[model samples]
Target chain A: MNQGWTERQRPPRLERRLEFADYETTRDFLDRAALVSERLGIYPDMSFGRTYVNITLHAQDDATEVGEPSRHFAREIDILLETEKTLDE
Target chain B: MNQGWTERQRPPRLERRLEFADYETTRDFLDRAALVSERLGIYPDMSFGRTYVNITLHAQDDATEVGEPSRHFAREIDILLETEKTLDE
Candidate 1:
């Protein structure tokens, strides 16, 4: 499992929750994450509130493991968040 | 509650699950939905798989109602799905 993600046993998914300072930043991150998902052709289950975003990536096909694509997507998400933070600063 | 959506009791939110024919279509709909959320300034908690997308919209503040924005967003989502179906035909 990745640092921020918790592995779910029943359905076999990797889940992560990220918190931001405020609503607009959280929403902006979601928008950017959506664009990244589109570009990468891999989408995560996502939920958000005023200050947090939750993402879950399910293991495909009976693999029982969070595949490379999911890992890559998660890493890319980290990068996106970092970039956004840099831009905000 | 809306036709395709269910009201969740504990957290007081509106939830819906939509099924598509294939993975590509599911992802495409997600991309479109993200754009709609951005445009509307309201985001849903979203999750998806090869053929299904699940969404939840939480009621803000202490209000137990789904609120105007969530309802409007849901209606717009229906319109988006209908428009996509027509284009696919």
Candidate 2:
């Protein structure tokens, strides 16, 4: 994460951000995220501003206790971003 | 979509829903969708209710006009759902 931008070159804002609370949760997570972006006037596959950025999310959670009470745990989010202009438009 | 359940077996409610405005936009779409789920107390990777359902989204937008003004168009949404009890709990 935050590997591309140099310390001085990175902007204060994130082009796109994806966070999740568990693993293999991308399917459900993405659904809700897209809904939010649409409400915010940002529709996926639709260009926004002058730049095209893609962000991804991957999440995982695990809590296993045989005899004791089960404790929930999750940490799985994968984000991928790309900069490009719309080819069709 | 909705191919698994027989007509009689299908429920009136959707286990999960994923809708998008374009194609190959999973990265950004998923990010925003997940955010919305979290706010809805349905954080990704976290079990909810008695069933585990996974929903996916795939969107595509295309507008090609050589001499005319471009008109935005998009229609890409894939949804998947699964019913299973939690193993850990």
Candidate 3:
């Protein structure tokens, strides 16, 4: 439950949908997010359209709670999106 | 109507699921597919996890038929996959 992220219960995961003005921005966000995953060793499931990407960070292992790692990954994604926006400004 | 593509009538979409051995290969295919969309002017919705991408090309202009353009785009995706495989060899 961090800002725009919604935490789901049954199958625990943090989900967020990010919107962009164009595909170029969307692609940039995606490419950078992938790098972040590699850096932090946390890969999320992502689905995208021309100007939007939905990211889901599922809880690690067989745990029943949305824990620290998912939160950290979500924070990283938030930072990534802000970094892209800052670059545009 | 392609080898791996299945046409869905209700939503009028041609859907295909592509499996990759690794994340790098998945990223390669996604990148190449984006380029193809730009080159061919046909965009399809893609959803992916760690090792698989599900692509759905919806019928254009509200038509009930999965038309030629959708088929052409699917063909391009198949070629893109093959092109990556060739590079890997």
Candidate 4:
């Protein structure tokens, strides 16, 4: 147990790594995500100049064998990012 | 860097620790959260029950001296839990 992780970091810089099914799904997910954040009163402060949303994915890794769920998530997040960009523009 | 974390854990057991402003807000957030998950094609499998939603709060911790944001989040999650219970009934 890294004591440094707990004591030094009171609440610590919390982050989320949500998985999804595919790109289209991720895009749909982001729409709902923004709504959820808004409802929670924790609006996304992209200008906060901090690592607010650090979303990563793991699609079918034909090279090293991945899980169905993992691949699905990676594809989903990727789609979410793409959709976010389009929505922004 | 704990090599065990990378090699042993392929995709790794991902978790999310979302923070909110207050209890009511968290409840609202949960409603949105469910919608978002469904949109993402990552519907909540509460039945699987393997540390899916591990929400914690740090509302006004007079004992250790916490921050407003942290306290706000804790209070929010507590409310969310309460609301979830009520919704179930």
Candidate 5:
């Protein structure tokens, strides 16, 4: 539903891919994202390489649908990324 | 190619799913795996929930096939897991 996220059908998940200039930046982003996830009490499924990170939030559950918490978590991540960008500048 | 890992066809990747007793153990395993990946100079695609971590090592590339580095990397991860298991005991 967001600009960078794709909704997948097979597993019913919202996915996003992020690319960074280097591995350090990518790792830093992941560390921050982990902290955010811990605070939010929700963890997105995550995959990463040297300069790329992919995150997925499942959309379907018995109690929740369409990844409501996941979307909120993504927004929080976006804020963290923005704050990191501002600091880098 | 080894126990606990499955070879997938769609994207041609080797995948392993690990389950932990708790989120803390899962995160600890992930942190150690990240370190091993960094030392090996190869990163696996990783996805995590509260108590499960799924990791995939791509098997196909122009220069590599069937995930040679990935299998080696997985072995390193297995070693790390063994070490952690020993520590836990």
Candidate 6:
């Protein structure tokens, strides 16, 4: 859904990086991402610092192709990023 | 001081890998780390998945040594992990 995502192959996954102005905003996004993971049962690997988060949604199997679940989860994360951005304004 | 920590060279830093039995425990550790960071004004870079977190405390400057502040922060984090472990029992 969000064109900002980058598709990566080899093992297959989608990744996106988002930057925030400060620690508070980054915390908010991480907390929201956790909630979404709970609701959808999709837990992406996330690496974050004070001002940024790198999220990776790996393919569900070893078929060398990404699937619906990861794409769906990425879309939800994209939505959360948008919501976080709006709050920053 | 907990001997479980690993010290790195080059840029110089202290690092430790913590494992949790579940996501809830992992979240608790992350939350407590944030609180400690705010109180002590030290923020370590962390990368975490569902069950583990890698914490790295960089040297305060370019002197190529992990100083007192980073050591103090690591001890506090060690304490937090101990407390979390007690709660788990």
How far residue B17's Cα lies from its native spot in candidate 1, in Å, is 0.9
Question: Lowest summed-lDDT stretch of 10 residues in model 3 chain A?
Answer: A1-10
**TM-score for chain B of each model, two decimals:** 0.91, 0.28, 0.89, 0.34, 0.86, 0.93
lDDT of 5 by residue, A10-74 (tens): 66777889999987788889888888888888877787777898888887565334566788998
Q: Please give the CA lDDT of all the candidate structures.
A: 0.81, 0.27, 0.84, 0.37, 0.80, 0.84
What does candidate 2's lDDT look like per residue over A1-89, in tens digits?
34432111122221233433343334444444444444443332221111222342212123122111110101111231221112212
lDDT value, residue A74 of candidate 2 = 11
Instruction: List residue ranges in candidate 6 displaced over 4 A.
Output: none
List residue ranges in candidate 4 displaced over 4 A: A1-51, A55-64, B1-29, B32-51, B56-64
- In terms of lDDT, the poorest run of 10 residues in model 4 chain B is B1-10
Model 1 sits at a Cα RMSD from the real structure of: 3.7
Return the DockQ of model 5: 0.61
Ranking by lDDT: 3, 6, 1, 5, 4, 2
Q: Could you give candidate 6's per-residue lDDT for residues B22-81 as a string of tens digits? A: 887888888889888888877788888788888888887776788888788899998998
**Candidate 1 or 2, higher DockQ?**
1
Model 3 over residues A4-78: C-alpha lDDT tens digits?
A: 898898788889988889887888888898888777777688999888899988877798877787688789888
Give lDDT tens digits, candidate 2, residues B1-89: 34432111122122233332343334444444444554443322212111222342112123121111110101111221121112212
C-alpha RMSD over true interface residues, model 6:
1.2
Residue range B1-73, candidate 4, lDDT tens digits: 1121111122222223444445445445545544444443333221101112232222232434434443333
Off by over 4 Å in 5: A6-13, B8-12
Return the TM-score for candidate 1, rounded to 2 decimals.
Answer: 0.68
Compute fnat per model: 0.36, 0.00, 0.80, 0.00, 0.68, 0.68
How does the DockQ of candidate 2 come out? 0.03
| Candidate 6 TM-score restricted to chain A | 0.91
**What DockQ values do the models have?**
0.35, 0.03, 0.80, 0.04, 0.61, 0.74
The true-versus-predicted C-alpha distance at residue B76 of model 1, in Å, is 1.8
* TM-score (C-alpha) between model 5 and the true structure: 0.81
RMSD over all Cα atoms, model 4 = 15.8
TM-score of chain A of each: 0.88, 0.28, 0.89, 0.35, 0.86, 0.91
Task: Tell me how far candidate 2 lies from the true structure as C-alpha RMSD in angstroms.
Answer: 17.9
